[model samples]
Target chain A: MTATQALVVPRGTGKTHHRPSRTWPMTVLGIIFLAIMVFPIYWMINSSLQANSGAATTAWFPVDLTFSGYEAAIQQQGGNLVTSLIIAIGTVVLTLVIATPAAYGLARFKMKGMTAFVFVLLITQMIPTIVIANALYALFNDWGLLNSYLGLILADSAAQIPFAIILMRAFMASLPQTLVEAALVDGANNFRAFVSIVVPISKNAIITAALFTFLGAWGDFLFALTLTSTPQVRPITLGIYNYLGANVQQWGPVMATAVIASVPAGLLLILAQKYIAAGALGGAIK
Target chain B: MTSLHVEAAEARSRPRPGGGRSRSRNRTLHYLTRWLFVAPAIIFVLVFFGYPIVQNVVMSLQDYTTATFYTGIAPWVGFENYAKVFGNPLFWTTVINTLLFTVGSIVFQFGIGMALALFFKRHFPLSGFLRSLLLLPWLLPLIASAAVWKWILDQGSGALNQFLGLFGVQPVPWLVSPSLALIAVIGVNIWLGIPFNTTILYSGLQAVPGELYEAAALDGAVGWKAFWHITWPSIRSVVSVVIVLGVVYTLKVVDIILGLTGGGPANSTQTLATWAYQNSFVQFLFGQGAAISNVLIAVSLVFSLAYLYMTRKEVDE
Candidate 1:
């Protein structure tokens, strides 16, 4: 009972031992983890700003922050920054229009074999682009759709649909069925109920689905590389490829382009950090 | 009193089975409306999604090579393309390389994610801020991350090399080395994947009641013992889901490798994904590429089915 006495001495009753606080250790570890996560991005920004004076060399910080790489990348890469922006924006629009309804369907409907259908949707998630790369290239050639905006949209859409469905389905499934039932009782038809009741309630899911699909389409490269040849339709990803020739890889401009293109996703991450974290965790756990 | 009782019985049976059948007919109409909502998506998939997948499989068996082109005949090469696949040492090499990448990514990614989750379970200052920041890598487009890493790992003058030089280590040829390239790319992937795994495992951990740990501690369980006995059981379902998903994801990953090395250094870092592309597109061996992809598809299907089965069983139990 001597050991018990030592444990009980804190409260002089039956209380456990009083331990010292662990605040500082946790804080230090948390800060270290943050640094590890943020350093690469910090390095990317710093390197992107460095001038050509030390361009051939490695320096962690910029000798002088210059916008010349950005200027050069924009001026020389393709038609203009406008073209790349337009293509990205267009991709986002196309992806949303197609993905939204599909997600709604998968989420709300208790269709026969819907679970199997979802499994199929998930299965198609990331079919190696290489598998159909040649045949697709050939098919596009035959149809004269190769390197066209329509072709890029179609290819990107194919990949986006499955992910959109999964995210949207989960979102829809979480909505209270009572509200939808109320709309039904009020004599609102299925379509009208979905539009006025179910959809408005599930706006957050819709937005998240849009954000996920848009980002995926925006950053796509392989299909962009294989599908499009002309600069007229090239997104920033493939546009950056021009800077990377067979021999000399232009690190300065490549980094600059990467920094610019990454801004939207970066900002979106911070803005929607909570939802993204939730979605990321929820999707993984489920 | 008898008349009142008869009236009550009629009222109770007013909505009969016949009426219920009519209600179902109305529901059938509602169900048709639901189909209408989902029909466009189905049509889109059938045309662009289903058609191409089926076409790709069919085309994989044909003699679609240039040799058959001049004759204008694609002769039946049933299983010959598959034979060519098994016969090639390169194909087997790609499979091995892909497996290594997948296994390495899963272990490190899950390990780091689990560690972060455990750490975050404790109430700490700026834990929320740290969690938010970690989402950057996973949220960013793979292209952007790959591009940034490409710059960071540049041999001649990259930040990674500069950082290494501080310790007097020579600059390593990250992308150029066939031996190091897959691992190098995998390292970046792990970085991208850790945040995702952390987010997932963290959420799963949060759902675990504090009472379980309190009870375990009362019984003298502490640290790893507590975790194995209490924490593991609580999060087992989520962990199983994550592992199966990790496998499927790592199997399908192509963009990172494509951006990093393009499966170069004599195809040393070539994965099944990249190999499928190379054979089908670059070599104009569409049949071979399709076969390789089918192999990937088959493997992925098996994992999905297994995960579904396990998850269903867990739910039932």
Candidate 2:
């Protein structure tokens, strides 16, 4: 109830606030809503454990759970999961390295065309991934980047960098200008000051950016589908897509693969809940 | 924010007693270093976004194909790609489907999201926990969600059919049938979209002062009337942002459709995005794909421009 009270009570009001007794019923209804909304995810896990019936005879629950689906999924998609992990981590590193400085520059700099640059970043988010994929396919083909990890890492980072910059810039913009200036006055250069001062203070925003970048890269399907043709560089997303392509007599392995693919998102949602919430608003409203 | 900008500017302009030439050189160095901060990102945007947009335009006008990759001989067709895209009978179906999918997803997603937002705004036990848990659908990979929903909506022994059978209702072919495929896909999209919409709108609702409701109630402006006069006007800007962003995101949705129905039962759910994918990757007709995606781009550009205009207006006000 303390959490509920914290949510219900507005700031700066010290009065004794009492929730009506009826509000408890609202909690039940809220749970039902969340249950419905999240049932697909539950079903994903449930069906993954059911025996390979090869038909729509999955029970409502995994009453007789089996590990064959997981064994099959790991045999099939373990490498792709690793590929996705490496790409996602690489995207996070590249995105933060490129976007963090740019975010700080745009936030603090009084340079000309900064607004125009920000405008362009905003516009980039609106462009469909297919258009980028179409052109990147031809470009990657010409540059010999097709079916390469670097190719996918670069493409996925491209999609995420703009949003990362925007998210971090909103946070960095609020940093007191004097914080960096004091370091500059102490004879540290801009880069050094940013490294020492801005980066540490903006840790929350940076992590939020990194988390989202990782998620974006992990969940990327079009770039993987378009840029990589062979199984060598396939991410688990495309792995699942291909699993669906086969006759799919048994969905056990498919659902197991889904559960595997969803671990990062689900884990982050639980562990980094505050950062994710901040990002959910920051990425959109800012 | 403006005050901080002015303060930073004043700090920068404060005089230092130095030789003019060295000062100019130092200033130049300073600007160069500033440019270095954003240069990589600018280059990335150029190569990834700018070049692709330009290349897509150029490709859309040519006879580019898988053969073009091999021969490097994409003859200039001079709008023939667009002509082909426009002339194809499936073109109109895609256009309508795209419109319907985007608009339908937005409408239901926003509506249900707003309702949930209002519901959660009330003080209730475990409300915060439930609301946060609601983000699971949106957080999961679209393909994963699509896979699960595909099973749940499977006609034979899918959970939905099984559940409906309890009421003696016949199995509904959610994804297989052409007539219902689009609606099913949109329903899944709405399910995916609700968490985001609800989270944003709930935050917006939270920002509305509680005092307004307390004051409105004294004048009998409670419940729906209070919401209309107080809540609606307050969250109008957030609503617009949500709607515009939703449209832009929903406009180019490819993963869900491809995973669920593959835009099929004879192309019933083939939006411009999927069509573009089919052309470029599936059929290896890069030019036609570029042309179709360019159309998608133009449609998204309209909404993006509207968003920019709205934000600018908000700033001015």
Candidate achieving the largest lDDT = 2
Q: Give the DockQ (C-alpha) for candidate 1.
A: 0.30
Give the distance in Å from residue A150's predicted Cα in candidate 1 to where it truly belongs: 1.8
Cα lDDT tens digits, model 2, B37-130, are 8889988998999889999999999999888998999999999999999999999999999989999999999999999999888757777788
Model 2, backbone clash pairs (residues 3+ apart or across chains), number:
0
Taken over the whole model, the C-alpha lDDT of each candidate is 0.70, 0.86
Worst 10 residues of 2 chain A by lDDT: A1-10
DockQ of each: 0.30, 0.49
Which residue runs does candidate 1 get wrong by more than 4 Å? Answer: A1-21, A53-56, A77-84, A132-135, A282-286, B1-28, B65-73, B313-317
